[model samples]
Target: MALNAAVALGSMFFGLVALFRPQAMPGRPLTSPGSQMTQPSEATTYFARMYAARAVPFGIATAAVCILLPSQAAIWLLAAGAIELLDAMVVASRNPREAAPPLLAVVVHIGSAVWLMTA
Candidate 1:
């Protein structure tokens, strides 16, 4: 439960950063620091902001479920895990070299989901 809360808060923080300070996001090794998208086009910026917006709500919902509706936490955690796993796959497909972090995140989400289910 505590772990879930922490993860949720962390997600919210990153989501906020991604939303307001997309410039702070890490980029690929070949790209400039804090610039994930190869070319900083309007469409890319829009996508970044949109992703951030989605993450913010997801984080809030996850935290709310963990705190206010404990019984639903397991299902939510599992869903989050599945989402992260798919995200990892997408990241890997786009950039194999930079997939480690997302893969790690998928592991953490899945592990947390398992823990929640067992607890």
Candidate 2:
């Protein structure tokens, strides 16, 4: 439960940052780092904002499930784990070097879910 709450809080923080300051967020650039496009395009910014918007709801839902439905928290944790795993995969596909953070998130989320399930 505590781990879920922490992940939720972290997600909310990152979501807020992505929504408000897309450029500052890592992995927002649509183009490869070696690409000549030094600046992020409007479409990239819009996509980042959309991604950030999604994070907000996901974070809120996870937090709510942890607080209001303790018995169902494990399921929510597993869902979050799956999402993180996907995120890691996407990042890895794009740039293996930049995949560390999402990969870490994947491990933590899935590990927590497994722990919660066994608890």
Candidate 3:
């Protein structure tokens, strides 16, 4: 449980990083440091907004796993992390140029998930 909590906290931290530094993420539509889509297409803006929006939920879920379900948090975290990893791969494969940061995060998440699950 302690390990799970630690992993969850770590995930939460990264999620916050994503929230605050969307551009620092090195991902498409989110490539600039602290970048918010403001040019070319409104679709890019929409995508950035959506990505920012999703961060909150992910952050909450991760924090919940840490604080609310210590005993089973590892299981939940692992599942969520796996889903994120798969999504990251999909994103990367489809657009390698802009998926770098996300791919990195996904790998980190996977490692933490593995640790949480196997701890």
Candidate 4:
């Protein structure tokens, strides 16, 4: 599979997981398995579900556009990358150490989009 497919698949998978099992999300205080907190709160659960609600559709649309319309893919891909950038910024503000992966994702998405446009 192509890198874009992989990225979209990952996003969809995680979104689905978060939607169905918000407590399974990593890094979340009370929700995450690795976290020390024992009790889950409504706020975290709400955020997890909301993230899934937003991310799942975004992933699908971006992947669909990239496949069905390559020229338009650049815009979609950049949008996907921008989401990662926003996540990176948010994560960085909370925990700098946890921001690397999202930042890398931003690079991959944006770089691929740029290459597609330039090609």
Candidate 5:
């Protein structure tokens, strides 16, 4: 229960960062201090913003359900896990090395789901 809310909040935070600073997103290299970061192409920025938009709403809804309807949170948890799994697959298709974080996210989501089910 708590895990779901925590993860939801974390997702929202990440989404917000990605929305405002897409270059700071995971797998997207960030320039070191003092070095100007190269801006991504229009298509890249567009897609990153799109992803951020999806994440924000999903996290908000998931967190809302977790707090307002705990009994229904498990389904959202599972859905989040599935989303991460698919994200991992997509990253793996492009670059296997970049898939680890999302794969770990998948594990966390599944673990949270299991904890919710057991508790």
Candidate 6:
């Protein structure tokens, strides 16, 4: 129970950090050629919006699952952590800019998720 709560809180914290400090994301070029590319991709703007828009909902759901069903919480938390980490990795690999924040963020997020799940 305590573990789940911690995971939920941690997930929320990381998500919020990503939302508020996206620019702080590291491992990507400060100004990648991709940056010139249209963001949220015109076609996928919906997906991007969905992610950004629902960040709160996802966090809430994660908390609910954690509090209500710890066993199942891990799957969702893991998925969320994996997604964030993978996004960071993709950004890092594709561009060469700042590698500190994104890398650190990913590590923290995944580390917290893993720790919470195991706890």
- Ten-residue stretch with the least lDDT total in model 3: 31-40
Q: lDDT values of the candidates?
A: 0.66, 0.74, 0.56, 0.76, 0.75, 0.53
lDDT of 5 by residue, 1-119 (tens): 66666776777777788778777666654454564676655555676688788888998887788789887677788898898788789768767898886687778778877877898
Clashes of 4: 0
**lDDT (10s digit) by residue, model 1, range 12-66:** 7766876776655544213344655454545545655876786788878887887
Model 2 TM-score on a 0 to 1 scale: 0.76
lDDT of 6 by residue, 14-115 (tens): 556545554443333133346663232332343334445555566567668767876665567666566556655655675645434445544544565677
List the pairs of residues colliding in candidate 5.
none
Query: Over 4 Å off in model 6, which ranges?
Result: 1-50, 90-119
Model 3 lDDT per residue over 35-71, tens place: 3553324444455456556655675676676677665
Model 1 scores worst on lDDT over the 10 consecutive residues at 24-33
Error of 4 at 51 (Å): 0.4
Q: Between candidates 1 and 3, name the one with more favorable lDDT.
A: 1
Once fitted onto the true fold, the runs of candidate 5 whose alpha carbons sit more than 4 angstroms away are 29-36, 93-98, 114-119
Model 1 misplaced stretches (Cα beyond 4 Å) = 28-39, 93-101
Scored by TM-score, the top model is 4
Cα-based lDDT at residue 6, candidate 6:
54
After superposing all C-alphas onto the true structure, candidate 5 shows an RMSD in angstroms of 4.2
lDDT of 3: 0.56
Off by over 4 Å in 2: 28-39
lDDT by residue (tens digit), candidate 4, 64-116? 77677767688788889999888778768767888887687788789989898
